[model samples]
Target: MRIAQVCNVGEICGGTAACAWSITLAFPDVDHTVIFLSPPNSRTVEAFQHCQFHSAKSITDGMIRHLNVDLVILHNSTPNRVAQIRSTPSIQYHHSMGSRTAADVHLACSKWLHQRTPQSTQVLWQPTPIPIQRTDNPSRNAATSLRIGRICTPDDRKWPQSLIPLYERLAESFKNVEWEFIGAPGTLRESLQHACRGNARFITADVSARSRYWSWHALLYHHPTISESFGRTVAESMRCGTVPIVDRKGGFCEQIESGKNGFLCTNPDDFVAAIHQIQDRNHLSQLSQRAQDSSHEKCSLSIFRSRFLRILNQLSLGDSFDA
Candidate 1:
């Protein structure tokens, strides 16, 4: 079956774009096309060369009219595009496109997201593809330093802002732990860097935070201030067998069973307690194994293919896959 994946951002490597690209790579049998609304990044444009691409500055009526595909999957599409393609046999593959979006089917990445979305939505687990080249040792390498990491996006929406004081207290209290922030410079990073001004323990590297998942023994992402449509980074770290310390909110809460595969925190106090719980190497090792195992069970390629086909079957567009 011919499938078209539509997205707004093409240049930035955010979760939306990442999910769209992953779909293209996952399905080789089904004819796939990427319809990008914004000016696509050169790297991504080249990557999608194996398939077809239609990049435009705006989502126009002509662009909508030209998509001759059996199924249209909207992955982070603009409202205009959503409206333009409302008539097509389409489903929205979204993380945070809230209610009011009209579609034949709506696939949200997290249960919380699905719950908030219009009744048409269903939970669809996202799959992350292996990077083209092996990224820097994703696994923790330093024996002395208890490496901790999280994305410091420009907006500082990744984690709870209310936990800043507690985070500062911990950073100062623990000498052996290293904190790594891998996004645009933000106020929180600045504060953490200021609080830990004496040494390199407070690291602010502009690196692919996702690639460094394995390097971090644990991800402290408690108190997600903004409602996450899907917590891709949480699962990414879990896939690397890295335990995540996340709040009891968003999509992360759906995949995680507190004290089982990962730690689920209620607030800053609970978050700090959870961190201490996995301080022991043996205990941390057990959680890590379970995290990776859970990732494999929920987000593996085979499972992704199965879900993709199932959705197609529901649409009555089932074309057998070589997957």
Candidate 2:
């Protein structure tokens, strides 16, 4: 089957662009074309070399018809624009929070997001594919020093206003704890530097890279200000066997089972309590393994491929939708 994925492929890694790529890569047999709304950089061009790329400022029914694909997948498009397409069978793949498209069939990246979508809308759960494989054990040196880390883009909206206060509290509670912030910008790093007082290290790391999670015992994430539609980074960390202690909000709650695979915190004190529980080596190991297993079971590439193919079959793409 031929499919066209329309999305904004900006410089930032892993968002709608990554989701579109994952869906395309899932079906090797299907012909896929990516219609990037923004002009993609050289990195994006090299990364998505498997599929044909097209640059366009806006999407229209005429443009989609020109592609002559069996199906079209819309990502990060305006509601009115999404509703305007009438000739082609299209599906809106919602990736960001507060982004609702006017498509007949909607696919949300997490159960949390699926719930938030209007009950009237036909929304299906299509989780973001987390393609991480861990050959090594996820156990860490928790007895000596606890490595708490978080990975995200340098978006101020994702960071809580009370982040500095929360960091100070955590530093005071644990004597041997160190915090690492990956993908932090200079402005965010400056603020964290003042609060951490030499206890934190800010690194401008790639968001899609798995090596960033290796040294971390726990992914301590709290984004109370702006919730994620799908916590891709949190799930990725768990795939690497790093337990996530994230705020009990947004899609992060769906990825973690709370005290089983990982911990879900509501407040600063809750985060502290969760960290204290993982201080025990045995407990940490158990949670780490379970986190890895749960992540693989939930967001593995195989499951994503099956779900995507199933969606296409449901749409009556063709009789050869079996995979």
Per-residue lDDT over 193-285 for candidate 1, one digit per residue giving the tens place of the 0 to 100 score: 655443324334322435677677888775545656677777777888789887787777788888988987776677777778778888898
For candidate 2, what is the lDDT? 0.74
The sequence of per-residue lDDT tens digits that candidate 2 reaches over residues 138-217 is: 33552378888977765566554567888888888886787888766666777786677778987764434446576688
Q: Model 2 segments beyond 4 Å from truth?
A: 12-14, 80-83, 96-101, 119-144
Q: Which ten residues in a row have the lowest lDDT in candidate 2?
A: 119-128
Candidate with maximal lDDT: 2
Estimate the TM-score of every prediction.
0.85, 0.88
Worst 10 residues of 1 by lDDT: 198-207
